[model samples]
Target: MFDIKQYLQEQRQLVEEALRQYMLAAEGDFAAHIETMRYSLFVGGKRIRPILCLTAARCVSDEPDVDMLLLPAACALECIHTYSLIHDDLPAMDNDDLRRGQLTCHKKFGEAEAILAGDGLLTYAFELISSEQFLGLSLEVRLRLIAVLARAAGSLGMVGGQFLDIASEGKEIPFALLKTIHRSKTGALITAAVQMGAIGGGAVAAQLQALTEYGGAVGLAFQIVDDLLDVTSSSKQLGKTAGHDAGQGKATYPAFFGVEKTRALAIEAAERAVAALVGFDERANPLRALARYIVSRTN
Candidate 1:
C-alpha cells in the first residue's frame, strides 16, 4: 500500500528543511521586520504547495536528486503560500486571530509589521526563484517558471479571486461566479505548484498538459473540501477560525449546495483529478493519492 501519511510527512520534512535553509535569518538592523516574517513562515502548516511541486517533479523525472534540484522552486511556492496566509489573516481581510494554531502575524506583530512581512515574503519568493541557486534549469525554463508563478499569484489569479470573494460578501452570487472566485483565489497557486515542477523536471508537452489538468481538478477539490470543513469542523480542529466564511457571508460550496452535495462535489473533483493521471505510471501514484487526500483532509 502507498502510505500517503508517511509520504506527506517525509515530503513535508524536506520542504521544511529547504525553507529553513533558504529563508532569511532574522538578525541585524532589520531584525524586527525579518523576525515577523520568520514568525509566520516557521509557524506550523501542512506545507502542501511545496510538497506538490516536489512530487510533481518526481512524477516526470527520475534524475538523481531531482527533489534537491527543485528545492528553490518548491521553497518559493511555500513562501508565496505563507505570504498569502499572513495577508489573509490580517484585520482588513479574514480578520482571524489564529493560524496554524498560533497567533496570526498581525495579532502577534501588529498590522503594519504583518503587512510588511507579507510583502517581504512575496518579494523574496521571486528573488529565490530567480537566484543562481536553482541550478540545472535553463534560462528559458527558469523564465517560464517565473511567469507561471507571477500570473498565478498576481491580480489575474489569487489577488483577483480574493477581490471577488470580498466583494461578493453578504450578496448571493451565482454558482458560476463562485467557481471563478475559487479557481482564481485558491486553485491558481495550487495549479502553478504542479506546473512549476513539471517545467523544472523537463516534462514534455503531453505530460505537462496532463499534469495541468490534474492540478486544476485537485485545486477545485481542495477548495470544496475547505468549504465543507468550514461548516462541519471546529476552530480547534482547523487551527483557525471556523465558520468565518458564513459569518462573513462569503459564498461557498456549502452555501450553494448542502453539506452532502458539497461533499459529493469534492469527491467528483478528486476523481477527475485522478483520471487526469492515467497517462502516467506508478511514479504518479503520489499525485493520485494526494488528490484523494485533499478531499478527505479534516483541516
Candidate 2:
C-alpha cells in the first residue's frame, strides 16, 4: 500500500534540508534583522507549500534533478508563506500569541522588528526567484514564475482577501463572500505554488490547466479544514491560537453550514481536487493522497 505518512515525512525532510541550505544566515552586520527573519522561517511547520511545488515539478518533468533545478523556486514559496504567517499573527491581524507552537514573530521580536522581518522575507522571495544563481532556467520561465507568484501574493490576491476579511469582521458575511475571501486569501497562493512548479518543469498549456484546477480545489479544501479546526481543535493541537474565527465573528464553513455539513463540503472539495488529476497516472498519486490528507490533518 502507498504510505502517505511516510511519503509526507520523507518529502518534509527533503524540504527541510533544502531550506537550511538556501536560507540566509544571521551573522552579518544586520545580524538581528536576519535573525528575526530566520526566527519564524526556521520554526517548525509542515513545509507543505515548498513540498507541493517540488512534487508538482517532478510530476511534470522528466529531468533527473528537477528538485535541484527547482530548489530556488521552492525556497521562494516558503519565504512568501513564512512572511504571510508572520504578518498574520501580528496584533493588527489575528493577534495570536503562538505559531507552530512558538511565540509569534511580533511577540518574540517586537512589532517593528517583526514587520521588517516580514518585509524582508517577502522581498527576498522574489529576489531568490530571479537570482543569477538560477540562470540555468530560461529567462522567460523565470519571469513567468515570478509574475504568477506576484499576482497571487500581491494586493490583488492574498492581501486583498485579507483586507476583505478584516473589513468583514464582527459582521455576518454571506457564504459567497466568505468563499471569495478564502479563495483569494488561502487558495491563490496554493494554486501559485503548483503553477510555479509546473512552469519550472516546462508544463504545456493543457497540463498547467489541469494542475491549476487541481490546486484550486485543494486550496479551498485546505481553508475549509482550517475553519473546521478552528472550532473543533485546540491551540495546543494546532500550534496556534484556535477558535479565533468564532471569537472574531468571521464567516466560516461551520458558521454557515454547521460542522457536519462543513465536513461534507471539505470531502467534496477534496474529491474534486483528486478528480482534477484524472489525466495523470501513478505519478500524480501523491497529489491525490494529499487531497484526502488535507481534510484529515489535525493542524
Candidate 3:
C-alpha cells in the first residue's frame, strides 16, 4: 500500500521549495504590500491544491521527471487558492480572524492591504502561467491552462458561488442551492487543480474527462468534510474558528442532512472520485488515497 503521509510530506517539501524559489521578493518600492502577500503565502496549510495538481499530472504521464515540468502550474494553482482564502477571510466575506492557525491577512495587516495582497496574488497567478519566463510549456498549453483557471476562479465559478453564499446567508436555503454553492465556491477550483494538472501532463481527451469527474466528486467531498469539521472539531484542531458556518447561518451538508447523513454523503462523493480513476493504473493510487483522505482529515 502507498504511504500517503510520507508521500504528502515529500510532496509538500517539494512544493514549498518551489514556492520559495518562485515567490517574488519584498524589496523595491511596494515592500510593505509585498510583505503582506508573503505573510499569507508562507503561513502553513496542507498545500493540497498544488499537490493535487502535481499528482494528477503524474497520473497521466509515464515520465519519471514529470513533476518538474508541472511545478510552475502547480505553484500557480496555490497562488490562486491562497488568494481566494485571503479574500474569503475578509470582513466582507466569511469574516473570521484565523486561517492556517494565524491571524487572517485583513486582521493582521488591515483590510486595505489584505485586499491588495489578495488582488496581487490573484493577478500574479495569471502572470506565472502567461510569462515567457515560465519555460517547458507550449504556448497553446499555457493559454488553455490560463483560460480554464480563469473560468474556475472567476464570476461563473468560485466568485459566483461566493456571491450566492453571501446572498443566501440567513435564509432557509434548499439542498439544491447548497450543492450549487459548494460546487462553485469550493468544487470548481478543486476540479481546475486536477484539470490543470492533466493539461500540464498532456493528457488525452478521455483522461481529461475522467480526471474532471474525479476532481468534481473529490471537491464536493472536500467541502462536505470542511462543513463537518466546522461543527465537530475545535478551533485549535481546525486551525480556525469552529462552528462558523452555523453561527453565520451558512448552508452546509450537515445543515441539510444532519451529521451522520452528511458523513455518508461525503463518503459517497469520495467513492465517486475514486471510481472515476478506474481507467488508470496504480499511478492513480495517490489520487485515490487523497480522495479517501478528504473524509478522514481533522483539519
Indicate which candidate wins on lDDT. 1
Better of 1 and 2 by TM-score: 1
Off by over 4 Å in 1: none
> Model 2, residue 20: what's the lDDT?
86
Candidate 2 global CA lDDT score: 0.90
Give the alpha-carbon lDDT of every model: 0.93, 0.90, 0.92
Write the candidate numbers in order of decreasing lDDT: 1, 3, 2
TM-score of 3: 0.99
- Residues 102-194 of candidate 1 have per-residue lDDT tens digits of 999999999999999999999999999899877778899889989999999999999899889889999999999999999999999999999
Colliding pairs, model 1 = none
In the range 151-248, model 2's lDDT, one tens digit per residue, is 99998889999999999999988888999999999999999999998899888899899999989999999999999999999998999888988898
Backbone clashes in model 2, listed as residue pairs: none
Ten-residue segment with the worst summed lDDT in candidate 2? 129-138
